[model samples]
Structures are given as C-alpha cells and as structure tokens.
Target chain A: MGYFLRVNILETILIYVVIPAAIFGVAALLTLVPGRAKSRPKYHSGDSWDYPAHWWSGDNPVAVGSIPDASNDVTFGGARGTW
Target chain B: MAHGEVVASTPLAADWQEPASGPLGDAALPLTAAQLELLDDVIFEAERITGLRYSVYLGDLGTDTRNMAEGLVKGLGADGPYTVLLAVSPGQKVVEVVTGAEAAQRVSDRSARLAVLSVVAACADGDISGALVNGVRMLADQAGTLPERTNW
Candidate 1:
C-alpha cells in the first residue's frame, strides 16, 4: 500500500490559484509589445518634428551628423520655394 | 553604364545600401521603411537616367534655407559640380533645388524651379515621399530628353 495523502486546502489554493494568477499576470504584461510598435509616429506638415537630418545619394548615402554651418553664404543659384 | 541594360519604366529593386556606421546608429526614421526604400529607388533611377548625381537632404534647412541648401550641395565635395541636390526643410515648409555647374548646364534654373514648385505642392498636401519622387522625376525627365544623349 503506497500512501500519498497531502491535500491541504490553503496549499491547493496556492498551487492552483495563486501561482496561476501570478503567471497569468506576468504573461499579460509581456503581451503589451504590439502597442509599443504601433506608436511609431507619422509626419504631417505643421507638426513639430524631431527627426535628425539625413542625406541620401545614389552612391554615397550618409546618415548625417552635426552638419557644418554654411559660411560666407554664397547664393549657388538654383531654385527655392515654400509649400 | 546607363545603356548597359534594359531599364524598367517603374522603379524595381534599388540598391539601397546602409552606411556601416553613423552617429545615429539605426535610429527609427520618421518615414516608414517602404517610404525610404521608394525614395532610394527614385534617386537611383533619376541618377541613372540623367547621368547626373542626384542627392536629397531632408530635415531642417535652418533659418536661411537657401544658404543651408547651397552648403549641402557644396558638401558633396569633389562630386559637387556634378550633383543635383534637392534639400527639403519640411518643418520650415521650404524646399530648394541646388544644381551644380555641370548639372545646371543640363537642368536649367527654370526647370529646377518648376520641379521645386511640384515638390512644394506635394509637401503642402502632406506627402513627403511623393513630393521628393515627383521633384526627382520631373528633373530627370527634363534632362533625359536631350537628343544627343539618348543613352536610354
């Protein structure tokens, strides 16, 4: 006769109720990733933008850094306009 | 190399390469990946068609937009005289087309102005990618139609 009798009511609640509740709470918290991804902002005119400057060339595109201020400002005449 | 192969009328896969290193290491772009890729393709195609280096600078153009734009074109260094630069300052709501001496010979001031106008109109409608593509295409088309260089 092999006896395995251990069924405390509080122990049962801790194993079946408390542990699962903690696990479920943690799992629910971890699943909030999509909400973060969905928050990538889109640009519209008049909206204050905070993106860094970028320079694109077909051959040598550069993710620009502290651009030098144009000195002696010569008008290299091309075309200028506003939206 | 422009005439080396059959060119597609629409943008195919552009050789959009990322710089190996930068100050802003892989920062998220305001535009989506697809938007950046499309701009890349348009620039590549424009360069191929006209044999003129086409570059774009997007962000603030400072208080004096023209001076900032002109400086950027000059920043192209040795390729300066052969590049056509479209510098757009969206937050400031201004756009500039700066063509170097060699490129200016092919794309006139009037034509560049017209292209800038198209860009501004598109930007006004809040279509940043469309604005750039339209400007680049118009400039390329104008320069590509020369009878002597039917390199296409």
Candidate 2:
C-alpha cells in the first residue's frame, strides 16, 4: 500500500508538472520559426513579437497634406525615444 | 449720491477639476506633456467608445511577458484604483501591455495580450490610432463592456 501511494504521488506530479513543462518547452522551441519568431533586443530580455510591419501603407489614412505630417506621427507618436 | 465709498467686487471661482500635469505627480513614472496628451486622447476616445480608462506608458523593462506582468504593478503614477500600461517601441516593434493589480482582477492576461497584439498588428499595418482603437475594442469586448449589437 505504501509503494502504491508513492507511485500515485509520482504520477500526480508527472501529470501536473512534467507534462505542462514539456508542452511549454515545445511551444518555446516553436517560437524560433521565421514569422513566428520574436525580435532580439540587445541588453533587453524581452523579445518583440513581430507582425507584418507597415500593414496599411497603401491607403494612407492620414494624407500627406494633413495638418501634421503622418510620417512624423509614426516617429513621434508611436516610436519610443528610450529604445 | 456723492459718498465716494468704493465697493470691492468678489469674483466667484468656478469649481472644476483641472487635469493634472507634469510627471503625473510621481517621480518613478516619468512622462512628458506631449506623451500625456497622446495618452489623454487615447483615454478620451477609448472611454467615449468603451468606457474604460486607457493609460499608456513608455519605459524599459524585462524580457518576455514577465516584464509586463511586473510592470502592471508600477504602471500608473499615483496609486489609483486601476491603471493600464501599453508600452511600444517602433524601432523594435516591441510592445507590452501591463495592467495594474485592480485591473488585473478585472482584465485577464490573455485578453490583455490579445488587445496588445491587435494594436501591434495595426501598428505593423501603419495605423497607430486605429490600432489603439481596435485594441481598446478588444479590451472592451473582454471586459464585456462592448455593446451587444454592432449598431453602437
């Protein structure tokens, strides 16, 4: 009975811990794919998960003749100065 | 009628809450007036459409989602009821959406992540405001604050 109980405890740990860890490991490995991969930042641990850059280049919602230059908005409004 | 007694006029001041300015009254969270203005616009537009306090920040932090999780704790300047931080860097396209303690309880990480992802996607497409608006919609949807029908 003692041996059976130990075996059950081991099984529980394997079921709850090991499996999830393995799944996460696999998921992390999958991140290396070209489109799926995250961008590398020097000295920063965080990776930039990229999407299609310049998703709306054609329409140009903010016209070139608008009050403020649309291109300036991208640099000033969105771009982070720190990074 | 020639008393020559002058009466002092008392001016009535309007009781209104003026928007606070400068570093948001917190040293830890550094932000400029322009940045605050942008965030205020986002919040105003978002609240008008979704009724949520949309706060954004720009700062450096750790890697992975963990950094954002940690940021959720220290996003806002003042210790308010709730705050959300959507940090973005165009050069790297690195974005992180961090929700405060109170906000975390109300907004799940997955949903918040989705919202951020949506915005990131939009930024990639070159629609900053559109991205933010879409992201706000996602958050509203997650919080069930979005209208039931598409009419609204």
Candidate 3:
C-alpha cells in the first residue's frame, strides 16, 4: 500500500507539474529564438518612390530614363545653388 | 466558489491607455496612390521630352537645403549630368532644383526659378501633386528643344 501510494503521488506530479512546466519552458524558448517569424517594415502609399531600392530597380512600374554614359559630357546646368 | 467563477472575477482592464496623438495616427506619406501615379507620369513625360532624367525628392533637407540637394544630385552617378533633381521640403517651404551639367545648359536658373514659383503657387493652394506635375511640365518646357541627332 505504501509503495502504491508513493507511485500514485509520483505519477500525479509528473502528469500535473512536470509535463506542464516542460511544455511552458519549451514554448518560452521557442518565443526567444530568432528567425522564427520576423516582422517587416510597414510601407506607406508613396514608400515605393521614397525607397531607392524600389525606385531605382526595374521593379518600379514607372519607366525612368536611362542612366547617361561616363563618356557623355554631363553638364551640371539649371540652378546650381540650393534653395 | 468554483475555479471557473474565481477566474471570471479577475479584472482584465489596464491602468494605462495609448495616447490619441501617436505615430500611427500621423501621416507618414502625404501623397495618395493616384497622386503618386500622377507625379510619376509627369516626371516620366518630362524626362522623355527633355531627353534627360528627372527625379523628385520630397522630404526634409535639414538646415542646408542646397548642400543636401547638391549631394543628392551628385549621388545620381553617371546620370548626374543628364539628371534634373527637384528637392522639395514642404515643411520648410523650400524648393531646390539641381541640374546636371548637361541639363543645366538646357534648363537655366531663371527657368528653374520660374518653375519654383509655379510650384510654390500650387503648393499655396494645397495641391502638392498638382504642383509637382505643373513644375515638371514647366521645367521640361523651359529645358528647350532636344539636341538634334547628327548620326541619324
């Protein structure tokens, strides 16, 4: 009877305490681990144009003019002074 | 009492609440989708007409707007000469037009000033997108005729 009681108490502790603690510990560790689910920057409507990666890339829907060649005599005309 | 009744008696209310004037409430980018599209179209059209690259930067320029504008123009790489960069800081009420050497030859300072005036006028009326469109068109018009292709 004493042995049976001891075994029953051990079984209750395992099922009620140990299992729940282990489950919670694993859950907390998983939450702390990096690269699980990363968040991205929120984009506004005009963000595509503001971001150089989007604007300069071919992915931009708007067709921007071609970049000039180095050999070209690129004049710095218009208003040289900043406003 | 039962366990369910004890749990139900607990209060879930918090002592603190988020302020109404938060970042989420602020307008990060003022322009709408259609307005951005309009500005893009205007810029592309200006580029096509002048045979030069046209780019618009709308943001804060810190204290020295001119230096910042110049740096932005210079950073255009090989396209700098054939590029016309319009930097507008609406908050500061400043507009700077930086042209590459090639673009400057066609679009004069006087023309740029005139374009600025048009943009300022439109801005005063609360039409930022319209201002950009009109400004680009005016700048392109003032850029004069594209050089003739001798090889053709």
Worst 10 residues of 2 chain A by lDDT: A55-64
Write the residue-wise lDDT of candidate 1 on A5-60 in tens digits: 56667888998999999999999998975664456765677776678888898883
Candidate 3 true-interface contact recovery: 0.25
User: By TM-score, who's the top model here?
Assistant: 1
Comparing 2 with 3 on TM-score, the higher-scoring candidate is 3
Candidate 3, B33-120: lDDT as tens digits: 5666777787766665566778887777768878887777677766666667777666666777888776776788889988888877
* Clashing residue pairs for model 3: A75-B100, A75-B101, A75-B102, A76-B100, A76-B101, A77-B100, A77-B104, A78-B104
In candidate 1 the C-alpha lDDT for residue B102 amounts to: 67
Superior candidate under TM-score, 1 versus 2 = 1
Mark the regions of model 2 whose C-alpha exceeds 4 Å error after superposition. Answer: A1-83, B1-42, B45-52, B58-81, B146-152
> Scoring model 1 with DockQ, what do you get?
0.23
Tell me how candidate 3 scores on lDDT: 0.64
Over A1-83, each residue of candidate 2 has an lDDT whose tens digit, in order, gives 78777678779899899999999999999787755112322222234433222111011111111122221121111111121
lDDT of 1 by residue, B2-117 (tens): 67787789879878787667644333776666777898999887776566778888899888888888788888775666678988888888899998766776788999999998
Model 2, residue B57: distance off in Å is 3.0
What is candidate 3's TM-score against the reference? 0.55
**Model 2 residue pairs with clashes:** A45-B63, A46-B63, A54-B124, A55-B124, A55-B125, A56-B125
